[model samples]
Target chain A: MTATLAIGPYNQSERPALEESFNAHVVADPSEAAGMDPAARSTIKAIAYKGHLPFGGAEMDLFPNLGLVANYGVGYDAIDVDAANARNIRVTNTPDVLNDDVADLAIAMWISQGREMRQAEAWVRDGKWASDGAYRLNRKVSGGKVGIMGMGRIGRDIADRLAAFKTDVHYHARSEKQTPGWTYHADPVALANAVDFLFVALVGGSATEKYVSKEVIAALGKDGVVINISRGSTIDEDALLDALEIGAIAGAGLDVFVGEPDLNPRFLALDNVVLQPHQGSGTVETRAAMAKLQRDNVAAHLAGGDLLTPVN
Target chain B: MTATLAIGPYNQSERPALEESFNAHVVADPSEAAGMDPAARSTIKAIAYKGHLPFGGAEMDLFPNLGLVANYGVGYDAIDVDAANARNIRVTNTPDVLNDDVADLAIAMWISQGREMRQAEAWVRDGKWASDGAYRLNRKVSGGKVGIMGMGRIGRDIADRLAAFKTDVHYHARSEKQTPGWTYHADPVALANAVDFLFVALVGGSATEKYVSKEVIAALGKDGVVINISRGSTIDEDALLDALEIGAIAGAGLDVFVGEPDLNPRFLALDNVVLQPHQGSGTVETRAAMAKLQRDNVAAHLAGGDLLTPVN
Candidate 1:
């Protein structure tokens, strides 16, 4: 029997991996493939969705007839695990494969801000260095304090990178950690006050919404820097701006945002912040590996084996 | 017996140090105190002169009676060393103390560019990270190659910083080095081609005029970055602009310029560089330490012991 498979928002990079593991491919936009419209999505027997469609979308109803849904990456926010469970449809996400890449990007962001890298590049590329001189007023990165928000795999990796700088690492989490050389604070506020640089690596959604608010930002104080590789909603944007304008905090480095594409105009004016067009897991090596893992998950589910990375 | 002293641009920071060492303090702007104008020079019995007048306007002939002239810092470009030698005035320069501080700024610039730091800061502080949704873009620093233009103490310290990054250190010097972990390249062009990043730590003078010319810049190609913390005059400014415009080289970090405080407007438009106000050794800690060292050198000279850091 030929099993029908619905492809999600993932690009062609995952094509080979998908073909290798699945029998029949239904390459449609997730919205269309998940029977977005009652009449359109009834054709698919199983689904493989990616970045499109939130977990509570109309497409989730199709899971009743679907056997499995393989997510493209570790963040399975777009797929509804609860709905899939009720319908007996298994859901899986690619997690372990992306840890290193995300961690590497996170570290790169931290160093980039600590060193004022892009400005350095502009200095030389603009010939200001040759004309006026370079690094005449640069800052130091060694012996700086690094605070990690959310103690997890990626956060630990960032700490590893900080070791080279001889930096002190502090972590803020719901629970305290017993890790040596790492000081644990009860929350982000206490942690922000004690560190020179703060990094956010926790999960997204309501539980963490606006966790870094005015109180937390004020604790960071002047000369303090923040880096967010976690969800943007965790931070209070308005509070952060107030801190930056009044010198309550020094600067920040971010890879995630709230409204996104429709970014805030005020952010465009600040030189203390660094901007990137989100591509954390976009590395050639990491993206390919993630695609492969998703493929493997699909193969395992079809072969009557347990899903590799189930989204409980 | 009265003694005269020439102080060239020596601010309050250097005053205390000089007072501790010298038995008599007769301060003259080096340009005027050195008797630059025969008619303006005072026929003092004995005096010490500073290297030069502020902005090169002072007449050096203010104090003709000076027996000893102590150089403040490593570079003696403002002092007429030949004239001092003719007068049998012993000249001393404070060197070793400031090497580590300058080197720290240089390496910090290097790593900042390699990591694209300024952009990262802009992303977060500007709140773009929160508004842009998801994004990840930063350069890696761990395994890149490092090249030094001059193999001096500062260059050595820079190489030491590279140890953590696991970089292969290469240097272009007048002669080969016996230092470990550094391979010497006799020519600047060869060195530029052999490394991912090139750092200029060479002295500025006739012998090293425009050493980093268009030829050397071309050799670095598109992927290589150049960092100059030594002196602006050591590089060919015109050549650097051309290279940057054509993308012949990736980027640069500069702390010194040919004619500073009057930066080129051309550089103001580029987005690939970092600019500073030439405060490499501006840190409070480093500056104080530098002042202390100069003072010690002056004290040793006054006591008739050999100068601590004599240039000749």
Candidate 2:
């Protein structure tokens, strides 16, 4: 039997399981994926993919027998679904498994920003607390109004968690959801204006790129904060940086960033913001579950069964 | 008329309010009190004390006409209550007002520790994320068992918040109350052993000193995390440091410490711990409420009205 091809920088522990289950051949990314012997590539029927590095029809054309692409995360924006659909390639993703982890992080970042947890921790570590009597008072987070940009699964999870924080959940979606007590705004700018915190939980990819526009950030005025757990593409980076620099918005607690890992250096200089290295769903339990689900989908494809979590 | 004496490092915003409310005489601390004239000392009938500085018989006796010690925080451990009782001096504390802020910090710290928020933020801030890949996977916080050491107002609030995070709430108090669906541990060690996270919210005083003892710390095995939002005296700090150093416990997120401001050097050296500068109630809204409550108690006393939140 030929092998299942795995791509992207997977954890070392995941490699063994991938190989043992499907006789998988792993490579760094698409760059190394090219120029594989035609015979080896032709035999590969399923691809277990990780990371968002565009896997369009051009990449799919290399593997003649490829029937399925199992993505390692909730978002499959990197996979050109339209291209795959034309070529009759099925797509599966790992979702719901990471919702708890992502929501936990979103709430953590929001609370950290409001309470000055970052600077306060530094004061304790750097002996400033010993010298200075008390840290300066910060504004409260609980009992504030929050605007969620999207009302999808992850957005709902974040809203549910923040609901426990005693925040009024106002939201913007394509249309209003059946969220009884939560106020819905048709326009994103209106939602931003109504809330003290703007929590971005929109889907990633080109369609929603810069969805959290300059107007929305502006509506979230001098006392408003922005907390993004969704993809960085959802927000306009330049506008956010300008607002943060000029104090047009109060502060931010960001996880995902545009061109992440190599994000804008301007974010590093801001004293008011709390920045994290895109670890929203980066937890041991959630990652393991995501990996297992990804493999399960691949296994289903090999066995000619239905995909576990098919995106398309 | 004689003025109400305010002591400890009150905020700049609070100073004016204090002066406006009672013609308040502000002093840094007790160190500055010893050399005051007898007439001035006698005039200070009520001391709006704000810190844990052993306001005992000696300090109370300094003011010959001292009738009240209104504490600026929920904990009145600093006030020698027995001594105050003997001298017929009433004690009042600012409570309920700070519960939301304290609980929010506890949950924030717990989630931050579980998700490695501190280290992850550092990875972004220090340009390590650009150099490295994603932050190393951390354990998930939601769906874990959390043991709250006390079931008081603040503890209840923490439990309520964590409940929303999908945690199973197990708590230990003097006697089990009417909390349905939550496990009640009679002993601290059992509570520590039963949960992955041990949250300290016990009342602060000699009775509860070292309540989270060496044995309890030991019971909270290698994977256990400790989150303290209560007073420093609730837990044995030395045992906590030793456990964190040797990995007897996974990590700690501490808001309070013994001899706070100047905590043990051992804590500063540990990377596994998240040290906060006692900012549980340090927010603009909450602190203002606390100050107003403290003043309200003083005002009630002057009006010969009922004390709002009296201790003794």
> Which regions in candidate 1 have their CA more than 4 angstroms from the true location?
A1-53, A56-59, A63-141, A151-153, A172-190, A213-215, A263-312, B1-142, B151-153, B156-190, B213-215, B261-279, B282-312
Candidate 2 per-residue C-alpha lDDT over B148-189 given as tens digits, one digit per residue, 9 for 90 to 100: 999999989888888888889999999997775899999899
Worst 10 residues of 1 chain B by lDDT: B51-60
Query: Model 2, stretches more than 4 Å misplaced?
Result: A1-3
**Weakest 10 consecutive residues, lDDT, candidate 2 chain A?**
A30-39
| Model 2 per-residue lDDT at B119 | 91
List of clashing residue pairs for candidate 2 = none
lDDT of 1 by residue, A43-154 (tens): 4455676763575535656534567788887766667667777777778878766665566556556655655656655565566655664343334555678888888766
Docking class of 2: high
Top TM-score prediction, candidate number: 2
Native-referenced Cα lDDT, model 1? 0.66
Which candidate has the top score in DockQ?
A: 2
- TM-score of each predicted structure versus truth: 0.70, 0.98
